[model samples]
Target chain A: MDLNIAVLAGDGIGPEVTQQAIKTLNAIGEVYNHNFTFKDAVVGAAAIDQTGDPLPEKTLKVCLETDAVLFGAIGDPKYDNDPSAKVRPEQGLLKLRKSLGLFTNIRPIKAYPTLIDKSPLKEDRINGTDLTIYRELTGGIYFGEKKLNEEGTVASDLCEYSDFEIERIAHLAFKAARARKKKLTLVDKANVLETSRLWRKVVTKIGESYPDITLDFLFVDNAAMQMILNPNQFDVILTENMFGDIISDEGSVIGGSIGLLASASVGEDHSMFEPIHGSFPQAKGKDIANPIASILSAAMLLEHFKLYEEAKAIHNAVEKALELKVVTTDLDPSSKYTTTKVGDFIADYIANSE
Target chain B: MDLNIAVLAGDGIGPEVTQQAIKTLNAIGEVYNHNFTFKDAVVGAAAIDQTGDPLPEKTLKVCLETDAVLFGAIGDPKYDNDPSAKVRPEQGLLKLRKSLGLFTNIRPIKAYPTLIDKSPLKEDRINGTDLTIYRELTGGIYFGEKKLNEEGTVASDLCEYSDFEIERIAHLAFKAARARKKKLTLVDKANVLETSRLWRKVVTKIGESYPDITLDFLFVDNAAMQMILNPNQFDVILTENMFGDIISDEGSVIGGSIGLLASASVGEDHSMFEPIHGSFPQAKGKDIANPIASILSAAMLLEHFKLYEEAKAIHNAVEKALELKVVTTDLDPSSKYTTTKVGDFIADYIANSE
Candidate 1:
């Protein structure tokens, strides 16, 4: 098999961590006897510095023409601190998502046994907890039409959803549920919001086709509470943009470390995999940022292409790293592992494993 | 001193728990030598069954005529299980809030020493957690204009905020912070939403007037995560309606049990106190429901009227009940204490304590 990948290692520790993911992917390609080609592209602050545009035309072209996009982190304090700045690094990724038609975001939250004690939740509560959030990324409040009155005293944002928008994400969530635990929980404020009622109606209609999968609904507030109280009860959790943003971020902490969470944003024709963590500006050249999130994102990319065995190999390597305590300072302050060293260990394990 | 209290024990366990609260209030009145009068009214499913209206005009009249209101839980499984019901038990509370102009919803979350172990979070994460959330109750998306397109396929809800709405709540939250830890964390999605930016601007301006209080900002997503990761880091949390609903509910569980959470909704001219937990229909007549939340709500009512000494007495008595392990089944299933027994103990403690 042949794979073409577009790499956008944006800023700060992004380049350092993304290099590790690429190294691990190369190892997988070697062991599996596959051809993997990579094309480099500038994005975010780095692109802004070079071309005065965060998502340069050539960069987007590379992403569009590739099999999948392997994205690192974006954002920079230079842009973040200047709130009045006309152009920002975040707008680049938002534009890319719109250009590439990336609509649905998938976030998988799992509590690894070795790290259960590190979670804020009790071991009994967090143990064996595995849930994936299917968040509708493009079509909710975030992208809604916003208004501010001439007096600047009143501001408003519209949260709108059409049946088409709900159908696309619902189908993907149902398919994911069918492949997993055969259960799906739709999080919404159906009793309050008209858009939520539409979401429930559309998701319910879609659920009928997948008769084997169980469908349930929870109000967003109740879902937020339930996420902490009993995380193990969920399988594939689906929600719209704003609710998803809050709940998925809430779910991210249950896994013990933000450094280990990865996410994927997909559309009909394209998908992008990236670590959920931001570019740690303070850890830019420190060789200390955790690489596991980036590496696992590569694993998700493999899974997207139906390379199950290859994905599993990366997963096993990651599990071995956790078991051996070969982690960066974030996971283990006493360990003598650099970002590159952790990547090397995982890549070696992938190549040498039975 | 004279106090006229309106009691609207809506449905299910509402009446039972409210009885406990009324008993405790009576004990406070006797100890403090204050003249207390009680008026009864119906709301929610009970009101619907009796008067065919959730919030009967007679009930609103009773509430408006009183100094303050003591609200028990609302909602019934019958109304909840029916999707097509035109009048829901929840609408009663919504109508009441709107009619009373209850713009600010205040929920205090504290991790009691005795019940800390009951929390799903680890002891270290949840212990010593004390925070208050001032949620804007009457505005934002919940009350925003909603629309469904002619095709019945598109739906939208507008999230709008005005300077007046933000200012009123900001002053209350700032006053709250001044009375406590002198720190105010305003949660909003300012980077994305126009309304949030308005919130940040308004809060920032108001925060300048509170020079002693350290004011900060957090996106709603980050606020949701921080509520669980490090709850003690917060002093006063101010947010819009929806974010408050989610985070307050999330914060409710950190105190070990929702059975111990109390909330107060206040406007300029009116206020209502209630337990955060819903009416448990299963325990309606079983005498097993927890009354601590309702009793604490009564304490809050006293505090609202500037009856600090009387409120402290109720708090001390409730704490004594928890200390003595005279809790309901939710906190301790094997406990032999019934709802009335726990209420009796609290009232007795208030009356007998020197």
Candidate 2:
């Protein structure tokens, strides 16, 4: 099989960490005897500095022509602190998502056995906790019509959801639940918001088709508490955009380190995989940033194309690295392993391991 | 001082737990040489069962005539499970808030040294966690205009905020911060929502007036993650209705059992105190429900009336109860203490302790 991938190594530590992902992917390509080609494009603050546009036409073109896009972290302190700047680095990624029509964001939160001690939660609370969140990305309050009164005294944002929007994500979430624990919990404020009631109505109708998968409902506030009190009880969580953004970030902490979590944003036609963490501007060119999330993102890219064995191989390598303590400073402060060294270890293990 | 109090012990374990709070308040009255009068009113499912209205006119009249309302719990499985039911038990509380014009909901989350083991988080993470959340209750999406298309294909809820709405709550929160740690963190989605940006602008202006208080900002998503990763960093968290609803509930878990948390809803002219936990239908009449939260609500009621010394005595007595293992089954499963027993112990200690 031949795969063409687009690499958007954005800014700060993004380039450094993304290099490790490319190295590990190359290792997988070698081991699986798959032909792979990659094209690099600038984005985020780096693109703004060079082309005066965060998401350049060339970058979008490259992403469109590829089998999948491998995204690194984006953002820089310079752009983040500037309130006056109109074209921000984050808009680049948002535009890319809109262009690609990526409406569903998949985040898998797992408490690894070896990393339990690293978590803020007690061992028993987070033990054996593995859940994936299917977040509807393009709709909801964030993209709704915003209004500010002429007096500057009042401001509003409309949170809107259509049946078509809810149905598309519900099918994906139900399918993912069918493949995993056969359970899905839809988190919404059905008692208060009309949109949430619609979510329940449409999702319940979708649940009828997948009779084998059990469906449950939890209010968003209760869902937030349950994420901390009993994370293990959840299998697959489905929610609208804002609730997803909040809980997914909350769930990222349950895994002990944000540096180890990866996410995938996919639509009907295009897909993009990226790390959950942002570009650590302070760690730029320091070779001390964690590369595992980026490497795992490459694994997700493989899985998007139905390369199960290749993806499993990458997962096995990651587990081995964790077991051997081949991690960056975030996981083990005393360890001297650099960012590239950790990536090299994982790549080497993938190539040689039986 | 003479005080007239309204008690609305609505449903399930509400009556039993509220009885303990009354007993404790009576003890405080005896020790402080104060005249106290109590009026009983019905709300929630109990009110619905009797008058077919959750918050009857008589109950609102009783509340209006009282110094403050001491609420227990609301909700029942009957109204909760029946989606077709036009009236809900929760509506009683919402209506009461609107009638009383209670715009600010205050919840203080603290990790007791003795009960640290009950928390899901590691000991070090929650050891000294003490934070108060001032939530703007009467506004935001919950009260916003909701719309559903004629075809039932689309649903939307508008989240609107005015400077006046933001200012009233901001002043209360800033005052609370000044009394506590003199640090305030305003949580909002300023990067996205127009309402949030308005919040930032208004709060930033209000913050300048209180120059002694160190004010900061965090996006709602990152704030959710930070609540778990580093809870101790927060002093006073001020947010809008929905963000507060999510984070305050999330913050509740850090102190171990939700049974130990109390909250206060205050307006300019009226105030109400209640336990943050819901009515547990399973624990109704079982004599096993924890009464500490209700008792603490009574303490907050005392504080609202400027009876700090009386409030301190109650706090000391409750702390002693936890220290002596006189807690109910929720805190200690094998202690063999009933709800009334724990309440009796707290009341006795408050009355007799020097």
Best-fitting candidate, scored by DockQ: 2
Q: For residues A274-330, write the lDDT of model 2, one tens digit per residue.
A: 999899999999999999999999998998888989999999999999999999999
Interface RMSD of every predicted model, in angstroms: 0.5, 0.5
Docking class of 2: high
- For model 1 the TM-score comes to 0.98
Q: Could you tell me every candidate's TM-score relative to the true structure? A: 0.98, 0.98
Query: Model 1: residues >4 Å from true position, as ranges?
Result: none
Candidate 1 CAPRI level: high
lDDT of 1 by residue, A11-118 (tens): 999999999999999999999998889999999999998999999999999999999999999989998889687778888999999999999999999999989888
DockQ of each: 0.92, 0.94
How displaced is residue B119 in candidate 2, in Å?
A: 0.3
Candidate 1 pairs with clashing backbones: none
Question: Which candidate comes out best when scored by lDDT?
Answer: 2
